[model samples]
Target: MSMYNEKVIQAFMSPKNVGAMENPDGVGEVGNPRCGDVMKIYLRVRDDRIEDIRFETFGCAAAIATSSTATEMVKGRTIEEALKLTNRDVAEALGGLPPEKIHCSLLAEEGIRAAIEDYRRRRQGLPPLPPRHDAVCHHEIPETGEETRE
Candidate 1:
């Protein structure tokens, strides 16, 4: 049987917010070297809320689905609210992902956080933060059913 659920397939096949934004308020790119999956997220924030969000992912179906769903999940949310979005939430929104593929959801979560941080930094006239490689390596494996640390 296919490991992916209907929701996952639907999202993967018809990913929302799949393109880059022009003059985005913030941008974040993350990758998993282990699997060679890369994802980039763009954000446009207004009044402390995410007015628009988009993503481009070069990865497996799970990665694409998570990226697409993550954009839907964060749009119209306050930056603080977006920060609270979790990998589990992304997975849950897609019904679920295979244990081994759960990391894709983490990528989505980190991408959104990184993008929001970038926006905050730019708004404050600060330089962009360094690229993040820790999102995958340091993150607790979400498939273990462990609660991730912020």
Candidate 2:
């Protein structure tokens, strides 16, 4: 827990834009079974720019902090700029995360990508993509509750 820096702690303690948006232009949700973390990102786009962004994250402190930072990074930027955001960028903005918790930053990046993809698809009159569940560093349990390794 001490692995978190002051930036991480501050963001976690006072997360920004942490909520759902009504009638959002795009929405993305991603979950990691390994850490039991779930993140949802909503976007309001106007004139090809992200006019507003919000996120809902259910995970550790790192997850929440990363979510907060990621939104701040891309807000008021073009969709293309938002897509440029990487997991490493999120981690660096937070000063850094513990080795085990670095996946949280990845989740934040994925969430942003998902949301942008959704926005683009909608603009093209395409269908929304299925929710994404990317298990990072954890194997999925089968119906029998067993982890099978080939």
Residues 1-150 of candidate 2 have per-residue lDDT tens digits of 446778889999999999999999999999865557989999999999999999999898988999999999999999999999997788888876766676678789989999999988999999986778764543222243121111
Q: Write the per-residue lDDT of candidate 1 for residues 87-117, one digit (tens) a residue.
A: 8899888877777677789899989988988
Question: Model 2 — TM-score against the truth?
Answer: 0.87
Each prediction's RMSD to truth: 3.9, 7.2
My TM-score estimates for the predictions, one after another, are 0.87, 0.87
Deviation (Å) of 20 in candidate 2 = 0.4
Name the regions of candidate 1 deviating beyond 4 angstroms: 133-143, 146-150
**Which residue pairs clash in candidate 2?**
none
lDDT of each: 0.84, 0.84
Query: What shift in Å separates residue 6 of candidate 1 from its native position after superposition?
Result: 0.7
